[model samples]
Target chain A: MNRKLLLAPAAGLLLCCFGCQDTVNTVENEPQEPVSNIRDVRVVTDKFLRDRLIIRSVRMATAASGNQVAEVAATNARTGVFSQAWSGITGENPYTVAYKFVWMDEAGMAVETNLSAWRTVQIKPGETVFFKSVAPNARCRDFLLNLKESD
Target chain B: MKFRLLLLPAAALAALLSSCATDSHYVDATDTTVAVKNKNRMSSSDWVVITQDAGNALLASPLFEEYLEAYRIDAEAALKEAEAAGEKITTREKLTAMKPLLMLSTIQNNTSEHIDSKLLTERLREILFNSGKVRFTTYAAGEGQSIDAATAQARQLKNDPNIKKRTALKKGTVHAYDLSLAGVIIKQTAQDGRNNEMSYTFNLTLTDNSTGEGVWTYSKEIKRQHKQGALSW
Candidate 1:
């Protein structure tokens, strides 16, 4: 009787523990994805920042009048990483980076322009790299820089 | 004695079944686990900024500093007027006063083109409301209080002739607030350039607090031409 009693309860307990389960949606190689990204970035501010981006020329034209652009200088590529860290965020876990550029005129009006390449980059841990982007369109005179945290 | 021995096992089995324990079985949705998440990626593509040597060279000029300083002041002032009412003040308040209300995530449209209006709008809305400046409202009263054709005859003696007057909030009627902001990403570039260089323009605007006019506007332009021997990103 004693043996039977112990076996029955023990068996039940094992079944309960073994049956408990939960699910989570996850994948591997997500590291290749950036930790953070910025969109709608408008201008480039710092001179030190100018060195980090790879710029390329695109086939685009402009309107007869200089105020508006009829075509754009499409960005052929962008950086996988750009910039420093802040807010106790560093390295691979909460990686921080950003990029930006500005638009200006020959007379420097800072006119409203349809601009910016929506690009994102992912940097591996312990890797130092620069960022790049092409002008969003023709008639872009100035650029701004944006550095943001990466996931 | 034999029966008693068997009773022990039976009692143990019963005890195990009745124990405060749980097991999985094919059951209704209520029995399933539910997950809650912020939906923002912890790691995403980093935002990059690129500049040209000429863009950098101009920064040494005094004008860039002056321009940036002015915009910094404007940004601080407007932000203060809206949020300064609630904060602990100290020395260097202007530089360190504003508090972060919304934890922003870079809204991305991983799809090829820039079709991120939905994400952008939602993020902006989150920023506005998260600041404690606005709250959500369903305004269910519109459906319940409006008089349909069935009740149209009951309003014949209404004193107010203006349609807007009827819906006008009474003096003491509690009303919720409405908040919104307009932000556009404007872009422009050079008319002539063929040296494998990149140039861009950014035109940002801040509107008036009261009249909704473009109170303050600023532009920063940067260009980078990669010289054969020069450093470029």
Candidate 2:
């Protein structure tokens, strides 16, 4: 009887673990033209933050005025791994993250533009979000994206 | 001794409570993670975000680019004409004389709370001016009286012999604006269960003075929600 009781609790714990794993599913149309002008960079700090906000790819394009435009694709790694950990512990609630883009010139100086404001967005488990920004002027050649957990 | 022990516990409790209180410290104004006490009213962070978005959109808009190009061509032509007419004008004078003037119209605040929309307008004006695309002029309810007073003062200064010849005030030199910027900020509130939500929509329109037609219009919405009990209604 004791063995059966132990097995019952063990099975229940296993079921709970598996049941809490709810990940996001997405369907997107295939692009006719492949993405070009993607630049690769190194991520050195904040491994924990990197695991949560995974930047998949970055594509550069030109605006109508010949200014540089960057599109960044990032996914929530926690949503894929933890999969509704907060909702499982408490109740159904969305998680929000704040992000901002900093534009830079050819001389590596930060552009004095008004595009550097924190914007908040809510993401589901394992969902990928695309953030886009245009250079303030033709002088901007590079960009840095900053992201953080929102309250 | 027992009473003394009771007093010791009370002192400890008081210390703990004081420690739990929040301490005053400096924080970044641009950081959006900081919790705000009033969710229904517009905050400084909201103004920053809204103005940034507006400036970015305006700078990227094709209409603004077109305006800049047209203004450059007109400025060059005007400079050439002034030089041909034997008017001794510097390059800066010619450029400033041709730059398009923008006047600030009314910014109606349709919210229940008393909000000085100037906070928002000033940021927008600063951004637009910094972009090197437009110039702003002050327009208020009693601006006519101020302009008349300034005109009278200029007339008196023009006759004053004490004034230097080079610094003499010129008559009929006021530049009229070619464009006007107007906007409205509307706030809406709703309640669901124990949660209260507030939405602020900022709508702005740029009108051409000659045609009285809106050349560019943009709107930005910011929504904030908080627990009903957390903030007093």
Candidate 3:
């Protein structure tokens, strides 16, 4: 009876650990529609973050006011929920990401403005989210987006 | 064999000590990679985010686009007509005259927090002013004036005899505002079991002073939540 009791608790612990790995299933159109994705150069310093957060595409548009707007589609590919939860130095979950858009003028000089501030978004495992922003002014023709793991 | 064992523990101790040593340094205030310290209240980072969101939205709105387009077309037409009529009015004057005058108005705060509304308005004013699409009037009649309380006092100096006649400002020079900007901040709170959530919404509108109609409106909401310990639940 004592052995059975110990086995029961051990089995329960095993089940909890194994079953806590959360993931999602997704479906989309078989033939994906054409998107105006731009060719972007990337510098990946954090391999772990880049591996877990996959960037799908980057698109650009010009508004009527002559300001440039950028949209980046990214997904969280983390398959282990319990193992990754509260793993950040600040106890932040890996699912939350902070990003900012730095704008530049035609001369490649950084255009300083209040619009270039850090913003954050939450993406569940296997879910995709788009980060969008308009340039600070019409003079801002180019942009560089910075991303980091955030709480 | 004994020496190898001692080296293993010494290396491990060094590694452990290195891991525990944290360097305190100054980082860029605008850097996005800075670790967040608190999420429950409005911090400097929150202000930065809010300023960016609201400023971008207002500057990119369709109404502001139309407003600029109308001014451009009108200024060009006026310049062409003046040139044909052999008038001496410069293009710069036409552009300046056509630029719409806006006055800052009251921003009602309905939130429980003692939030400084200037954090939003000042940043917005800087962005809009730098755009060069609109102008702000220092004084408005009947309605509230801009944040500069010195406009009226400066004008009152015109009556002072001690002031030079050439440097003194003329009467009837104060231009009335063509538009006014106003806003409101609202807060909502909820609790479920051990979880607490707070939401704040900022709503702003630009009203045409002549027609008394809101020409542009925008709103943004920020939500934050914190869950207590598992035992609390």
- Report the lDDT tens digits of candidate 2 across residue range A106-143: 89999765567777777766788888777776778888
**DockQ for each candidate?**
0.02, 0.45, 0.43
What digit string (tens of lDDT, one per residue) describes model 1 on residues A70-149? 11122212222222222123343223344333445456655331123233344332334444322322345444444433
lDDT of 3: 0.75
TM-score (0 to 1) of chain B, per candidate?
A: 0.24, 0.75, 0.71
Q: List TM-scores for all candidates, in order.
A: 0.21, 0.78, 0.76
Task: Give the DockQ (C-alpha) for candidate 3.
Answer: 0.43
In candidate 2 the C-alpha lDDT for residue A125 amounts to 66
The model with the greater TM-score, 1 or 2, is 2
Candidate 1 DockQ vs. native: 0.02
> In candidate 3, how many Å is residue A110 off?
0.9
Q: Model 2 — TM-score against the truth?
A: 0.78
For residues A33-110, what per-residue lDDT tens digits would candidate 3 score against the true structure? 545457788999889789878888888888877888898888787756354443332344437788888988879998
**Can you list the residue pairs that collide in candidate 2?**
none
lDDT of 1 at B77: 84
* Candidate 2 Cα deviation (angstroms), residue B85: 6.1
Instruction: Give the winner by lDDT: 1 or 3.
Output: 3
